[model samples]
Target: MASRDLVTGKIFSLQTIVGILGNFSVLYFYLFLHYTRCKLRSTDCNLKNLTVANLLVIFSKGVPKMMAGFGLKDFINDFGCKFFFYVHRVGRDVSIGTTCLLSVFQAIAISPLNSRWAELKVKAHKYIATSNIFCWILNMMLNIILPLYVTDKRNNTNFTQKTDYGYCYVMEDGTVTMKIYAALILCRDGFSLVLIVSASSFTVFILHRHKQQVRYIHRNNLSPRSSPESTATQSILVLLCTFVSLWTLSSIFLICLTVLNNLSLWLRNTSALINACFPTVSPYILINYDSRVPRVCFA
Candidate 1:
């Protein structure tokens, strides 16, 4: 094996291990809360769904990359390639949608009574399940076309019309129809990103306003410590920042890979690493910010 491949394999192996453990920790903590009849917040549902989506991304994207890195590139057949690619695309889209949903809900939850979002605040929690279900359905439908375009690399002899994804071959002709389809996919992702940014901005404004109101209390030595609301707000803000940053980086890598007619193994490895970064790091953010997680762990 090449030295570069060995290094990539080790790195992916670590990411796969850490991401799985962290996400499962979050899932286990939430499941424990549920089985124990612990009081759950409305946002907990979103967190759980997000964790599941992260797991899906890790298993479908990260695991395959790891296997490829370890010289198992030819292990996957046409069916496996299609299945993994399809699941990864669906999982990634769902993750973005869930994050957007969570951000909007947080903004609504913090809205002032006289604000335009007040009405949403009262009914937001009620729609969490419905919203999550819709997100899954929408993404699944959107990415159903992936399987048709993906096949095992070993089985394909054509090099002029296919892009190698290490373990799978993506049939791309750069035709007008394919370009239009790609544009539509970009539009869908762009819409989700816009919503996320707007919701996050609104949440930041509300938090800032609340902080200003509470400044006087702290100044008067009334309440020296921060409120639980403040902590939760900080968590959401950090989560949004982390997601946006990683999402931007991953998108760049993905676009670079997609537009290139030839496959560069280095670019492919780097892209896979960037794509897995959010899932690997996000669970740690949640674990650190959520006060209840430690309690459940100790219990």
Candidate 2:
């Protein structure tokens, strides 16, 4: 019942509610598009998966943090802690995985027909579904160990309960096995980061060239109404930039929180808050990105 917890709780509670509403609203748009279309486009397919990934993030991480904020400090037990962290890690990892996929797929979608990437577009549909399944498998396998390390902090005297957010981390064993496992996890995330950046960069490169081509044809007199491709590219660029900025900030702070033992609690909450904002904002971006979709569909 500390004053700080009360304040933090209220703020995160508001964040969680906003996240749910925003993501679900986007979900509705996707669902409507799915049933109405004769066939689903690769972008829509990737986005549908992204919607699920973001929702998983909200349900997995946001809800627990919100509960903890509402003074449910000890509401969770050992099993509950295990379940919460398990789902949270899986959801967190999957969100990043899906983002990487979305970036790559969109990049491929916009690639020139003669380009090597465009050749893969034919298989993009199948590749996306298969990749989605692979992503889920990889995330679940990698993060299943998270719950093993997490337990109810109240019952354990040896490990310090983290006060930054809802979950507690098990004390590091310092054994070679634990060290290797840590490295492996870092490598997984590192690869995901590299993919995200590379994909975003390539997308922007292609889009820039595309814009130049259009400019040459129109003599720099572009139409007020944007083409679907143009709108999609702009949307992807904004989404990728926003995602990378937030992801980098959260990753840096979370690593610091884990490595530095003397950091204050406020910093930890700040990191969690950053992590929570991405899911909420991303859905709105997706919904508003294309003026053609919902308006045309509902009309």
Best by lDDT: 1
The digit string of per-residue lDDT tens for model 1 on 8-42 reads 88899999999999999999999999999998877
Which 10 consecutive positions of candidate 1 have the poorest summed lDDT? 156-165
Instruction: Write down the worst ten-residue block by lDDT for model 2.
Output: 159-168
- lDDT against the true structure, per candidate, is 0.87, 0.77
TM-score, model 2 to reference = 0.91
Compared with the true structure, the alpha-carbon lDDT of candidate 1 equals 0.87
CA shift of 71, model 1, Å:
1.2
- Model 1's TM-score against the true structure: 0.96
TM per candidate comes to 0.96, 0.91
Local accuracy of candidate 2 as per-residue lDDT tens digits, 126-212:
888889889989989877666666667576556443433455545555668667778887888788789889988888898788777
Question: Which residue pairs show backbone clashes in model 2?
Answer: none
- Residue runs of model 2 more than 4 Å from their true location after superposition: 160-169, 220-222, 296-299
